[model samples]
Target: MKKNFKLLMLAVFVAAASCSFTTKSFEDPDKDKLLIDLITYVLEKGHYDAKQFDDSFSEAVYKDFINNVDPIKRYFLASDIAEFEQYKTSIDDQLLAKELDFFNLVYSRLDQRIKEAQTYYPEILDKPFDFSVSEEINVDYENLPYASNKKELKDRWRKQLKYTTLSTYYDNIEDNLFKIENEEDYTPKTKAQLEADARETTLNSFNDNYSFVNDLERNDYFAVFLNSVVTQFDPHTNYFAPPDRDRFDLQMSGRLEGIGARLQKQSDYIKVVEVISGGPAWRGEHIEVGDVILKVRQEDETDPTSIVGMRVDDAVKLIKGPKGTQVTLTIKRVDGTIEEETITRDVVEIGETYAKSAIIEKEDRKFGLINLPAFYFTMQDYEERNAAADVKKEILELKQQGMEGLVLDLRNNGGGSLRTAVDIAGLFIKEGPVVQVASNGKRKEVLSDRDSEIVWDGPLVILVNDASASASEILAAAMQDYKRAVIIGSKQTYGKGTVQNLLDLNQWLRNNDMGDMGALKLTTQKYYRVNGGSTQLEGVKSDVVMPGRYAYLDIGEKEYDNPLPYDKITPANYSPYDGYIDYESTIKRSNERMAKSAELKLIEENAKWIKQRQDENVVSLNLEAYTQAIKDREQYAKRFDVLEDYQSGLNFKSLPKELGLIEIDSTLGQNRQRWHKNLRSDIYVEEAVSVLEDLKLNNIRQGSLAKIKD
Candidate 1:
């Protein structure tokens, strides 16, 4: 009886995985089965919490994989989903057997759907939309069901396109009205002509989008399938395709071994998209964005090789190499002038990848504001270019300029290196245990600062928001735990404590048979705060909760799918710093002040309204109704204009040493000026400054009431 049941299940799976809904046959399966087997072995061995590949896991993958492919319900009807559900439980069995039948069937069906769906958009756009109709479209895709039939699917596409066109239509009208309001002589385009333009723009965008989608190879589909499978284990653990790996490294580290300029394949020549901040190209100051690379030459060669029509991957091979190497490129500038630009390859530090400081002066007190965008550090060279060392340098410079208090701005700092976090924490207090890491089977390793001497023991205030993550959470949590720094921002920091190690797939292979299987960024361990709690889901609780936009939104590490469960271990041995004794009373007084401030109350209300508006997806297609909606929103938006307009009354300036770089790099100078301008108008910075004043260590007797008046 059991054997018959097993055979019956296998039969159902075979039938479900075979139906393609297309006449065109998929490419013959080659290394896909092998790839799946290899990935399974790695995930089983490497992932911190490998789940049993049972019926439950398979069902989760079946649902998530489909959503990842067709999120908007534009593809795959209810009939298709019904057919595919037959193998939903047996997908785990197939995966164990290293089968591609399930993936192949879905991939083929999606391709067929895409081919058919691409036709509907152009057809819909060819006709003019009647926006005067009293109808609305529901864009709540999560709640939406797949269309029952072909005609219904076409109608869905029509409504979606019409809504997109309406945005362009309204923007055009607003531009013309603005011109009229400013008394500029202008003739507005007729409604018919305006409709045509909007349709054309929508059509062009659809075509471009479909073109890119169609260009994706089978490997791309495999990547999606692989991630769908792995991310089921944990959000942080997954595979990286070659291009994705490059982008991840660049974005996270902001430094690559390549020529420090973003490149795009533009027809024939590889165009420089944009120069990286503080990169080799930026330092060379010879090549700029919009330059066309025609020829490339290596260090040993006298003659340059033309990469005129080479693939971007192949061209990049000729360009990127080891540090201290030289690569020369003949390029056409935007003005059509041709020149040879030689650049010495070096580790290009992305401007935001490190710590930057500004001396903010208010009421005869100079407070240091360290805007650490990300806690970046290169493992290859631990001592060089880490966030900790750079922040220490910034602090020393600010102190030279008579900085009294410090505001460590961790807002939007999606964190990096863990070692740097410990080191940075050391700089603020007399060092002890900073963080604890626990591997799969190993004992918890308590990371501590051996350094006894403090760098900046002055009154410290850490400014964090929901976007502040990982290493940022560590530093904030440490300081908050030690009662060393006053934490102030949105109620908490972004909770992400898991540590990931990027393992090269080639390292796992005994012999090189399947050429680069890409890399696996597997979550190997979870780190805990020194005070025993893990920031896995529960982020660092702020001392003083302030009003901001992200407060009401589900935007944190906890919001991610399949996150690791938060747990606690025995607390690491650490001591509280007696540097700032008035922190507790200062926080109490601030909360009292915040309770009385109408501005902060108004800000919280505005945050709730924004979240409510974001949750509303259904929109009217009628032009008059749409315009009225926009006007009503604008009327409400006018009330919150005072939120941004609040002046900090803080004077910010770059240190004398950095001002020279500002002179040499005009981009750096312009960015500095812009940042200073924003700081001058920032309400949060003003509030932070007020907090800093209250935190002035042993000198709290001079302060009676907060300077932020009623």
Candidate 2:
């Protein structure tokens, strides 16, 4: 119902613009009377009570309409500004009456313009839109800092309309919408029906100016705007609208009384993005990712109320409540089965929010795996207690634990603070630039570590997948450029290199009385690696590439609309690590072993099997096929050996009394021997260890280092 307010307001605004309503025209008295009568007719039909049409409300509405509709406000000519001086001051009664007449004249002109616009609106539907006509869509930053003038606002609408209309032709909206359903439930619609529906939906809501202005009224627009503003001040200071604020409050302090799942509005239907790790939904084992939520029923409710087309936060409110309360969700599963599941909510603690460390012992070498879910630090907490210092302490502990090699798993780590990323990268590098920021043609600021102390410098590797973005990409690129760590992951990262400036649209137009125009997230700058490569569309490439499920999908910066173009800048002079480890021969040997091994060969050969599981669109029409698909996928994934297998092999190698002597001596020998012996059993871990050993043996190992006792 709260969401409906925004939609209704937009509909009313659009309807008003489309109607043939005008004010009294001074040039033609008869036309002016006709216009006034028309306005009266609309007012009556719109259910605006004639009795409640007070002077104050009229003034407010009139001012709002003028600001919204007047082309002069968006782009006021010098002469027009001069002409408006007569209306600036309060006048005598006689003069006031004349001024109102002049105002009516201007209002009538705007009314005529709107009527003229309607004629073209229907024509836009009939005409086939050609998107190839590229126009220079650059905004004049100097002239219009904020779109306050009416003409400038119209131009913004023109550009927005052109882009949006062009986009509709390229995007298969029907396919995207229908893709939410499971393949089994998919009743294929004829191409004609799909096209007709798509076109109708698009055309019915095609007014650019109305949408542009209406978005300024919706809470999400302000939520994103305020987030941008707070982010500009610092990444942690966020602005949340009512729904977002409610969600945040629930996540931080509220108890979950319903199913524990984070939902998002994916087009029309609500899709489950994540199931709370230990919540009832996760424990129930019925809900899974990619499942569409159709309805939700409260404990006392008899009928399940449909939740389709509801905002994510609204759906969340319906699903979340006090602990002990039961909530039922009608879920459409990935396999096309719709089922109702009831869950009792409880307190949800975010245990998986931080960086978790694990020791994966492959052969003999123990590799420390640190999975950083997000580069997060509460700014308020940091201000009160030293958070960066604490993270450094943890890294030092991992290093002290006798970790031969390290894997910084940054999968699904949507970036948080820039400050934290730089600080974390500083733990690896001694003292150098980590990332560079170029904004508004100002002197580029190089963020670097001033500290000389280094931690975990032995053999470092960073693992990332498609979801690794922003600050994650920044750190990965810096480490890769400096040759500090070997990056192993998918083809590239989610390339979001541009920086945005949060402009308070309300603040800029305070004098104009534009209530809650919200904030604008204007892309103001871009980040560049110290080596001069831009991380825009082409994200950082891994040193050792690994196959990922989303490898075939168009996953990165190129998939977004109006993504900033990638460009290079002057490279800052920085020292590269001169010391190299001799891991070449060991890597070659490990690669040969992995290539010929039947288990590894089988896993590699079953790429298609993995792909089918990864693909979101691959659906089964029947229960049998779906069961078989799931079975086949599970069987193929199990070909990869577990960590215990490597440990068993290492134990087996030390079975003979003579093998114990070799093991003892190997540990006492150079780090390379210890690494080689440790890597022998765990294929992948051993491969990384061998690479480190080869680097050490090659005499290219940089910096003076000492091996610490575990």
Candidate 3:
């Protein structure tokens, strides 16, 4: 099944084989123009459902590029938009002609506007906001119009800045009051002082944003323009710059050669958000979340470059290097102590990206729950470590620990390797056609598990949500089609039927002097279920629908712009699993139980409340009205607070093997403890386990638990 995914890639390679791209000299020396030419060529030659470069396409690119540059209409004026509208229907022609006139004009104009806009925020925050004035700001930015003139634009910035500073101002007052009562010899600040502090904080944030914006190079904006052009083909299709491609590779492999500390830019400092377990940062205990990285110095360099006010990307470049290299970081600890720490970079594996399992005990029965965060795998070696293999190992371990049933949690799993999805699906059924993939003008290929061995044939439950997509959908749809598992969670999974192949653009060049050309994630094919249904826009429907936070929200692939149309192909020859006595009855029982579940009803109510809050975007600028509105919402929200405290009463613990590992690695132990605790309180997991309990095995699959216990 894994090899078949490679064959699909082979087909993509073959489709573009005729192009015979090489490092041939181009008359156009501009890299941006060259990229446009190369990208458009690949799109036309390789995209599964390629679009024509017509006036309509040009119009789409124009609109999307403008939106990409200034989404909130805060930068560009009405006159600027009117000027941009002239080339709205000419972008497609420019793409084909390898011209960057439109992109150049917009980029230069945006640069000028941003520099001018910088003067406005600091001036606006200079004077204290009149919070007593009865005013409101509609934050539906998409529908909002550009400012008609400079005065209107500044006014727009005023309302937005006031709205932003208002919350902080109120918080300052509340915090000061609390400190006055609680702390000994507390210095109390007046409302005016608090307002000034709030304005300063807002001003600092603006400065940080402008600092980042200023750090952006022309190549960065070109990447945005490239993506705006490529994504017009489909949402999944994208152009990744060199750095972004590296990140994509790291994400797919879940391994990177670095110190393994996830950093975020806050105000001016690059703050450590998470120190990945088993990495140098975690091992040395020199860095922790909330520590601010002040400077980075390589072992080869005598001087340390101060990272204050630098973009996080640039700071990261300074920190990350070849494995075995050393980098010293000047850190300001959470406790306010400044120190220098040197760390040797190494290949850090992100444990969270892999499959993790927990055994749940309910009324003396054991059930296996494997949470597959993503269908991760090594890019170079498929057998090294992967989601499917790890899951199989976990299942076997759970079986050793007397697991009678299994719950494969695909919630928030945005999908990864297609091969792993096929292999994972094979673990349940003996052998069958798992999914059917189709490319343009090619025969449909059915990716099946050729192996006849059934790893776990007992009762099964698949937990999913709107975030479960691509490979996740493939697995869930396969199991559902086979009637081998009861699908639980959201009303439907994330509808991402299309498959993307990451093509390194540098491969097309030979004897090339140009630096890394980055990569293109092109949508190459669309996959369908064995039952012939496409999960494109209509993702896999849950056997037992449950209310979720996204229930009332427009989410998933259906919400994406320019998504591929949903269509079905001829069904693959397959038979449903006969292990279930009555699969329909099992689903019905779960549905009835869910219908009566008070916890689920409460969750549904909370979801509706969240949706209502999201819909109410207009906010009052008056401090008193805003504070009252927040208090009123919080007062109404108190009923939903019990949802967080709800416990399934199920006992979740790591298997014996993991328990041993946990004993040595306290971080892993803590993470597992937190996960198990969350599982215990998770209403969805509780319901999934309940469904597992209801799923009975036929005699053919009976005594499997007994065999496992043996």
Please list the residue runs of candidate 1 whose C-alpha ends up more than 4 Å from where it truly belongs after superposition.
Answer: 1-30, 180-185, 264-271, 277-288, 291-319, 323-346, 698-710
Worst 10 residues of 1 by lDDT: 1-10
Q: Which should have the higher TM-score, number 2 or number 3?
A: 3
Give per-model CA RMSD: 7.8, 17.7, 7.1
Can you write out model 1's per-residue Cα lDDT over 142-164, one digit (the tens) per residue? 67899999899999888888888
Per-candidate local distance difference test = 0.80, 0.54, 0.84
TM-score of each: 0.89, 0.47, 0.92
| Residue 347 accuracy (lDDT) in model 1 | 74
How many backbone clashes are present in model 3? Answer: 0
Among the numbered candidates, top TM-score falls to 3
Error of 1 at 127 (Å): 1.9
Clashing pairs in 3: none
The TM-score ranking, best first, is 3, 1, 2
TM-score for predicted model 1 compared with the true structure: 0.89
Provide the clash count, candidate 1.
Answer: 0
Give the per-residue lDDT of model 2 (tens digit) for 1-710: 00111121123243333222111112443322332333233323321112233443333333333333342232333454355444333212212132334354444454444454455445545544333343533322223344545555455445433434433432344464556575777666654454455455555665533333322222222132123212222222233333443344333222334567777665567899887666777767869999999999998999998988664555777888888888888999999999998888875644456564545555666556666777665433544322245456556665665666666768777776677788888877778998888875456888888777677566777877777888889999998888777776666888878664333434433354322332333455678898988888788886655545456555676774335668888887788654444333433454565556554444344544555444333233232343455577667566654422544242111112224444544322343344345544544443454455444512334324432211
